[model samples]
Target: MEKIPILRMGDFLLVTIQIDMHDQLALKLQDDLSNAIQQHASKGVLIDISTLEMVDSFIGRMVADISGMGRILGAQTILVGMQPAVAITLVELGLSLPGVATALNVERGMEILRRKIAADGTDERPG
Candidate 1:
């Protein structure tokens, strides 16, 4: 399979993690995120969950893995647009995301990333 796609929006590296409901995408996640952080030098990461139908234990483990790897890669991972039902199911299935950063949506996630960048004095808004 091809490497997962990761895009950059401001200081956030937007990761649209690709995976089947029952498959393992963790190693690919690590590789793709490694490329993203290296390529863009971003301060944060966002996983768009609006496209996911179900997140199982394996995926949850992947999320935790990505979060830890992201920290070492110099980016904090965040989950965005996670459907409440999916979130509930993940929790009910005993899957925790291991302190990965999370946001209600991509916009919020970008804001968080921007805040982090700004805290580091990198604010350069286009006029």
Candidate 2:
């Protein structure tokens, strides 16, 4: 089974989806990411999906579920690098992905996460 890689960057978890998403892969990603967030005590999650040209309803819902799960785990989730067509498909499929923040790229996504951490006034940086 192919798995997506989740990297830890400071107080955030970064996920870059480089391959096409299947049902099983998406499920695995959700489980793995949930574990990572708790283990790392992540404050935020940045998911980069720029490489994906399209997204089916299942993939779209999985993305939303990941974001919600992150929130439940006490981490903010930001989705970045979404293609225009993918966005359209998501809307067409009625997946608005409520409560999920989005960014144009990884750099901007990281910035949003930093701003969120600052706003929360609970910096997890090591002294």
Candidate 3:
């Protein structure tokens, strides 16, 4: 199984998650990404989950955890490319995320991150 990948696109780390119907990968993804986000603190993240058919309770919690952790690490985390069905389901599940912005697409998320980084005067590549 391929590990869930998070790609660095300009200032925002764009991630596209692929999960099977069985929902086996969510836990590992959370643990790995929690560590990865902590390691790359101060870098914004944009997650794309449009491909995901559904987001269960466990995965939703993990995502919410990442959002909070990203803030603590001085990074702005955003969710993009979420299908309407997934979005509605997440809302109904009472999944809550703190400090995580949602965008319609990767480009919008990246734009927001750019403005954020520019305002903070931080270079995307770091020193």
lDDT of each: 0.76, 0.89, 0.73
Checking candidate 3 for backbone clashes, the offending pairs are none
Q: Candidate 3's residue-wise lDDT over 1-127, tens digit each?
A: 7678766554456668876634556666766666776665547877788788888787777678778777777778888887888878878888755456888887888888888778778555643
Candidates, ranked, lDDT: 2, 1, 3
Can you rank all candidates by TM-score, best first? 2, 1, 3
Q: Which lDDT tens digits does candidate 1 get at residues 1-127?
A: 5556777776677777545533434566667787878788877888887878888877777778778877887787888888889999988998767678888988898888778767666546532
Ten residues in a row with the worst lDDT in model 1? 17-26
Q: Evaluate residue 111 in candidate 1 and report its C-alpha lDDT on the 0 to 100 scale.
A: 84
Better of 1 and 3 by lDDT: 1
Which candidate gets the maximum lDDT versus the true structure?
Answer: 2
| Structural RMSD, model 3 | 4.2
Best-fitting candidate, scored by TM-score: 2
Is candidate 1 or 3 superior in TM-score? 1
TM-score to native of every candidate shown? 0.81, 0.91, 0.78
